[model samples]
Target: MNTFRQHSKTRSRAVLVAGGAGFLGSTLCERLIADGERVICLDNMQTGTTGNLAALAREPRFSLVEQDVCDPVPRSLEVDAVFNLACAASPPRYQADPVHTMMTCVMGTHHLLDHCAAHGARFVQASTSEVYGDPREHPQREDYWGHVNPIGPRACYDEGKRAAETLCFDYRRGKGGGGAVDVRVARIFNTYGPRMRPDDGRIVSNLICQALADQPLTIYGTGEQTRSFCYVDDMIEGLVRLMRVDPAPDGPVNLGNPGEFTILELAEMVLDLVETTSRVAHEPLPTDDPQRRRPDVSRAETHLGWRPTTPLSAGLPPTIDWFAGLVQHRRADRRAPVAEASALHGVA
Candidate 1:
């Protein structure tokens, strides 16, 4: 446990964000720190990057712990709350190592639940809309059991999250052999914003990166598959509200914007935002890809009083700018080595 040396006085709260160096986790860490909470960011750095935490480099209230959540947490560490955002969320990344992804969702969640049970800390499980796999429900509500194929290529992530949700409720029901743990589960939908990795195979990042790089925006399948998008800031607010809401909700609450759009609509929007010669290209849809996904966030609104405020029109601009900056930086970095080699060869 790294101590906050500068703040001699104890802070109001200490929150541990597992997978905190990742896209959403890093943003949550920044928000918590800005809200005057001491944050212990635990991550294995598998899909996460250290550059995401650069903003907090000099902040004493923030500490980064490089470790896998599947392992037992240190007994000495104490926190008021724990946000389990540990597993790889993207399909390409999670499917790359299916077994590890499953273990991270199951064992990693078990470890965190145990820690929270012992410490009497509130726990927030960042379950996903994927749990509602290829959902038959028009607008997926918390009660939907999901239409997941247990043995499909994407089953690793879909089933893993479902298992994690089971663990959370089990702990909450005191079935894990101890007092009931305070637990909240948020079924997050498609969220996008800054800090998203260009290589992440999500639609938002994919189209944005391709447009920035002058490559064709690949649309999977017929491009009519619909999905709801929530801004990262809005998602963070929902999570915070879920954590602090009185009397934790009995079941998972959907946290996302209900405004839905097709993949073609998103690609068109991205192309319009970015100044590039990129055109739309069709491709084979991956296995178990959901045709339509729109969260019914009535549960979130009723319980947490949270509803997404940012529209896609408002959100995509900043997201494009962030990806554009990253694309530029990467291009510059790649050229630097070549330039150095050319200089060494005296090839002006």
Candidate 2:
């Protein structure tokens, strides 16, 4: 059975990180392990690559599961805590396989909740700010009912996650076999980081990739659409704090940086960081994209004593460096010859 040391060796005990090979998941896994916890990473590899878990593989206490969360977890292992981050957060990736995306949230959530029930673990749901849809109010709080269009293309992820949150609460209120079954719901906002996919259409990645490649950064709709960015490290810190909250705050906290910036302003920041001559171009925004999305993190501050600490000016350097490294790796790979590489195997 999974357990924690009473005297404290590292900072955490055993942690189950679902979708641990994706950008956010992998980062969470790394943090958990660094704090002296054994980590079990569950992922299907639909969007996550092995590269995300490579660095963690050498850690004796860390392991990755190549299975989808929709399937039942094996009976042998016990987890002290479960972090359900299996759903896709980016618009393009989730909308690409809408049905599977929904399944991952609905069915995947069921599987994780069941595991939590069996193992007597703390369950943390990686909920999204998208739950608010196009916010009807500024600085969306956890109490806001949201204005999501259930029939829009974006509905698959937005509504699916909303429903998943409901299921979590349902099980918690039912007083199921899961001991305590305390749920930690984090409504995360725009978080950018090192391992993010270069082509996810997320403004940070898009701007960095375009700037590094000296290509024009495409701005969807008016560049005036606003978003608040919390760097990945800050986000992970908030999540961890929420997980370990004493008296176990039955939380649905907004874990995000409240600092707001426009798409165009973010692009300019990227341009300045990468020192690129890349120009900005306007493109039609996809369906149901939120024009203004920022989190109201007062509850997090008042309850969890957590708020983002990383400034965008400071955060962009490392992110730009990461993408720059990836671009260089790709360019070098392309020049190496066809026999040595195959697109089916994926680029670095």
Candidate 3:
């Protein structure tokens, strides 16, 4: 049976991290492991790659389970906290399998929250900024009901998350089974950093990978769309703080950097950082893409005392370096196979 050590309230214990092999989840898992906490890292590897968790494979305090959240929840695990971050957050990837995405969000969240309720553990629902839709508000606060299209291409992810949020609260209100579990919802904004798949289709990773490859950076629409980007480290910090804060609010709180930048500006910054000769290539905008998306993190700041400190300029260098290394390694691996073949044929 899965179990955890029980001690002081502030002491480290076993935390179940759904999607723990993912870019964001891997980072969160690493952070928790470093802090002396035992982690049950669960993922289906749909969008999450095993490479992200390579470093933690040997960590004694960490355990990985290759299971999807849509599947049955493992029982008898005495978990202290449950972080539901199992759904795909990328547009191209999630839209490719809309029904699965929705099911992952709704059913997956149901199973995780059920586990938390059964154990009387804290539940942290990783909601998204996509729930705000195209944004009728300037800086989206938690109170905004949002303007999402239920039938749009992006609706699977948006509505899935919205439904997941409802499930979190419903569980809190004792509407579902098991005992009442402490639930905290964080509406995460655009986050980027190392471990993000080079082809995940997010603007940051896309621009960085493209710049490194010296390819024309693709811009959808006029490139005037604005978004707030938070480095993954800062995002993890906010999530940890939210999970630990006492007297936590039942409503969702925004977790993102307030520093906003236009797509054109971001493209320019990436180009400048990489010093690439690549120019911008315009394309037709995807359906229901948000024009401007930024979070008002006042609630996070006030409630959890969390705020992102990394500026885009400061965060880009490390990310660029990481992607550059990946590009180099890929080239090396490709050459290695060819070299071995040539060696067998007595060619230099």
lDDT of 1 by residue, 1-348 (tens): 112222336455779999988899999999998888888888898877767777776577877777898899886778778999998999899999999999999999999999888777889999999998998888888898999999999998999999999999999988877567889999999999998888888999999999988999999999999999999999999999999887889999999999999999999999888999999999999999999999998989899989999999999999999988887666422212433322211100
| Candidate 3 global TM-score | 0.92
| Residue-by-residue lDDT tens digits, candidate 2, 1-348 | 223224246444667888887889989988998887888888887767667666664566877677888788875667778899997778889899999889999999888888877876778899899999999899898999899999999999999999889888877775545554667788989999888888777888988988887899999998999999999999999988888876455647898889999999998888777778899999998888899988889988887898889999999999988888888777322121333212212211
Clashes of each: 0, 0, 0
Q: What is the lDDT of residue 154 in candidate 2?
A: 93
Full-model lDDT, candidate 1 = 0.87
lDDT of each: 0.87, 0.81, 0.86
Colliding residue pairs in candidate 3:
none
* Model 2 spans > 4 angstroms off: 1-12, 175-180, 331-348
> What is the Å distance of residue 201 in model 1 from its true position?
0.8
Select the stronger candidate by TM-score from 1 and 2. 1
Per-residue error for 290 in candidate 1, Å, reads 0.4
- Output the worst ten-in-a-row residue range by lDDT, candidate 2: 339-348
User: Distance (Å) between predicted and true CA of 231, model 1?
Assistant: 0.6
